[model samples]
Target: MTIDRSSMTALKVTLIGFAALASAMGVGRFAFTPLLPLMQAHAGLSLRQGAWLAGANYIGYLVGAMLCSMRVPATRHAVRYGLVAVALLTLGMGVTGRYDVWLVLRFGAGVASAYVLVGVSAWALPALAGHDRSVWSGWLFAGVGVGISLAGLLVLLAGARGYPPAASWLALGLASTAVAAIAWAPMRAAGASAAASAATQHAGRLSTDDWRLVLCYGTFGFGYIIPATFLPAMARDVIPDPAVFGWVWPVFGATAALSTVAVALGSSRMKSRRVWAIGQLVMAAGVLVPVLWPGIAALLVAAVCVGGTFVAMTVAGLQEARRIAGVNAARLMAAMTAAFALGQLAGPIVVALAATNGTRHAAGPSLLAVALLLAGAWALWRSPD
Candidate 1:
């Protein structure tokens, strides 16, 4: 009935990793999604401008992912330093209303987020596996969704109370700072263990399967991002009530948080790639839902479907990376992350260009995303178990 010392340590480590991810990804990377509508209403921000800000963040993500792939920073150092950067950059977003300044801040946050993501995975996954608590990975990754839900709910509450975008930004920044403080010591304890493991992994070229995994991950990134980026805005268009439309993002994030844990619990017999394939198919269906149905109801369905599967796909893909690359998994994880970043970087630009051409909704890009997701799912299905 009593938990052992090692078990306690493993749980502590997992919770720290969870907090790090929630701060880095939920606040640093995605606080903008829920805030975009507030910015549009109170700050006179345009959809085209929002798209540019999103694009800038994704570009920074690509840069950070590439740096991680090269192993430019130690895992613990990267996580600790990156968390600090994320807190600063997120707070900076509220310091000014200038579009140019916001661009720079979002970009910096993106870089910090990628570093934390790769660093945490590199650091925590091994420790969890060592303790035979690998199932805890679902909870670790669930930080992204939980963070997303928290950020969304905060913004939703603030918007209802007549708070401006800056106020919401400040609130999230303060919250991220607190999370960083909590995660600091445990993350520092990761030391050189992750790097030592990486040093022993294969230095050979990637196989066809590895390459396929990277490409499919990239497709998944592109496929889900349109809705991920603009679901709140899209819902706002369909129904203008902030109280009503504001619920979309939190619903999306809640589904995402819960689904990963469910998959972790139930996927013992399934191959990681197979789980990933099914997730993609489900996401593709979600992307197609609004286009086919054209209503607020459909958008909520898309949110559930897309949000639910994206994190599951992320867990599956990363687990597959570890299975295939062993101790060398960090580099492979980074490479896959870079590809995902590239896909993410493209999504906003696609939307920006569409807006420039006077297309308002995500329909056009959503269609393209669905096609690519279907293709990715097909490729993943063909991959060996």
Candidate 2:
């Protein structure tokens, strides 16, 4: 059988698309969550400072998403600038001896990550047809999991070997640059002709449901981030082995990757609102596990449950936004992203209040917040015309 040139080209395009999306989604956004503890320890950051840094990143993400949603030319220019920004910001993260500078760098990284995610999703979605759209989109999103897991592994290796924090960050930055270089060819091809057409067709103002979805997604963001940003440190406090902390993150990322696919499949058959509510409930249960059990097993279970639902909520929330906003999907997505950013900003502050009591009991208030948010989401899901 003779191989067709067009078929080969299409295969190459698909592979490249996945790689680019993975680089943008995975390494760009998620690596920070897993590295929080290392940054805190090496940089001598207080809990409040750590929360502020995390919040700053989310704020930057909000800014980037909003910027991308506004003008076609700005969005296009962002793709080129965003990659370089991420490379530099990530490289700067290595030099965390200065808390203020690290906070600024993390914020820059968040901005760069938001642009990459929004830009790539916009460019990639139209190229996909029917089921391929969902599949590719889920896979692209899973890049966050892959990137997170890799970051954990790298940090674990670096920390164990007693590498300087700056060196580890620098290495991660170099790796990101390499991924960006590999991604450049495919991103350029994907964005070449269709960018203008897609922008014109998809760009618009946000709708009422867009607001509701944003409010709901912001709650989901608060619910998930509390666990993600603090779980490792929590585990380290309870677990006897320092090495155990490293495993928690990989577990979180791995389960998150698997659950994202599951949610994508479930969305096709079930209403997104229902799926989202259920995911939140599941996450609440996960959050409570460590609180109730106060052991490594509980922490492991919590990571899986919370990690799975975090991305699932985003997927379901975005789908709901599309249904509610109709043609204004891009604007709606940006709005939801903004809501998520605000929620993320609030999460650590909320958790910090619980931590002030000087007990692992902090997990209790955090989990309670998650449960209440999910209950509210369920009510929202049930509401009808």
In order of appearance, the predictions have TM-scores of 0.96, 0.87
- Most TM-score-accurate candidate: 1
How many residue pairs of model 1 clash at the backbone? Answer: 0
- State the RMSD for candidate 2: 4.0
Model 1 residue 106 CA deviation (Å) reads: 0.4
RMSD of each: 2.6, 4.0
Name the runs in model 2 displaced over 4 angstroms.
1-25, 72-76, 130-133, 202-205, 323-326, 353-361, 383-385
Positional deviation of 34 in candidate 1, in angstroms?
A: 0.6
Q: Clashes in model 2: which pairs?
A: 26-143, 26-144, 94-166
Q: Candidates' lDDT values, in order?
A: 0.88, 0.67
